[model samples]
Target: MTGPDRTPPPGDPARDGDAGAAGRFADFGPPRRVDGGLKARSTRGAIGVSWWSRRFLEVLESFALGTRLTRGRSYARKGQVLRLDVTPGRVEATVQGSRAEPYRVGIELPVFPAALWERVERDLAAQAFFSARLLAGDLPAELEEVFADAGAPLFPSGVAELTQRCSCPDFAVPCKHLAATFYLLAEAFDADPFQLLHWRGRGRAELLDRLRALRAGATDPAGATDPAGTPEPSGPDTGAPDAAFAGPTPDVEPVPAAGAARVLAGLPAIPLDEAVDRFWLPPVPLPDRPPTLATGPELLLRQLGAPAPAIGGPGLLERLRRAYRSFGRS
Candidate 1:
């Protein structure tokens, strides 16, 4: 029975329904503008640096709500987002819109339970590549595959896995503010991918310590304890000498008191600056012979175990000793 131009008259029930629809449309009006907000470092091009970060964005874009991200992108580029705080399984943020006060936003993901994380830590410890890189504080690019193999996907698999909300009037689930926060998050992952792991209910230090413990236990299956329950020595023990064996013993030289007393008295007196420069600066070619204890700083330290007030502060004397320690090692 309905046809074009057969519209409900004003003040009618049907007319009221049309007014409600118009009011809902008005809610999507121009988003509030933000000035001096936190701008995305990337003014143009993609927001993420690594493949994982880019993939994160691609996943967001794939959602039915993906097209809404365009407005989010604009907000992000313009730096409309005010503050973003990320924690394990949760993110809280604020985005400045066309209003005097900023809109609050939140995003949540499920934290992997302790049991699942234990399995992940054990399996990751077993992979030499994963362990080596992780110990070095670098997350492997292929780490996602490891999570998949362990039956837990690190990134959100779909919109169902993520819960997003905004205080803005926009009925769109994410609204543009959520999008801006997401773009900023991708940049965060680029800087430190370990954040992704941290978000999954484990922190960098905790995970590293656990991996170290697992490795140590695997290497020492006996539990490394003595009958008394005290920890046994970690280093290898050199068994007692063979009673029947004969080996050449190193010759030991006896110290001559008078000679040692005369050693420091022998060197010619030189200006303090000249002596210090000679000690610090290396020669074009290193000398063929090493400086003996009697001729170098060792003699000074031995004579003055408690250094003079002038040279003692800030461990200046200790540093001099360290300088000589490097000689043999180098």
Candidate 2:
């Protein structure tokens, strides 16, 4: 096979044919019937959790029974043929070239959805979940029951409950064909924990529920009000000064006791824009404009008993004259 120079990585699945497995499962026997005596499936344990995909292994680890999935020496690397069958389940192929006889074989890996993993997300302000329980092999008891009830199963000490089968003619002592399938399924498990669960008819939904609870517990309690509360306007004394600036505006009239005409008598007919501009803009030094401040020399002198002209600054008129002089110069 020099076409592409393909060597099946130990435990790598060959989708189309068992020839790729190269006699890996030849010693393994045929797949057992679903209703076969418990001893059939009971005869074989699952590959180790570490042998499967990091993802599915993670979910398994999260379960209370994670360790139950690993069978023997974990066979960290074994060759296998994993394939989707023409019908329902997946198939495994093992080619035995050396032994009592040489033959090509295939077996189905179970892909079911026994327990649904619940959806979960970390509350940023709360816990970092993926690194916690899921990775630590601490699954809860509640979800374990759901998976057990399903015909699909989990290896008591391992991560995934995989199918064991092979096309070998030998008695079912884990002939190479089944071994290849087991190894292949283990490799597949390492690729994605969900794939094994899917075969076992399980999913992440249950894990998600646990995650929800985990995260919920870790989250900081919300304010006395909303956990994520919208801020509210507080008491008048405790609010912003502008927020407290209420009641009749200084600019608004008091309504003048109904019929009493509002006397615009002494007030100047000042434009609104000019008033707002004066209130908002930086003070302007105008050559001809009258003083904006109403308090004057006489009033200041009479109110404060000060000397006539001014204290520290130039006289108002002199300042006005100097401004006019500058304007003329410009």
On TM-score, the candidate that comes out on top is 1
Give the per-residue lDDT digits (tens) of candidate 2, residues 179-231.
34444455555445545544543344544555556555444232234457763
Model 1, 283-319: lDDT tens digits are 3343232111123434334323445678675387678
Per-residue lDDT, model 1, residue 35, is 66
Clashes of each: 2, 57
Compared with the true structure, all predictions reach lDDT values of: 0.66, 0.36
| Native RMSD of candidate 2 (Å) | 35.6
- Provide the TM-score for each candidate, comma-separated: 0.59, 0.28
Worst 10 residues of 2 by lDDT: 255-264
How many backbone clashes can be found in candidate 2? 57
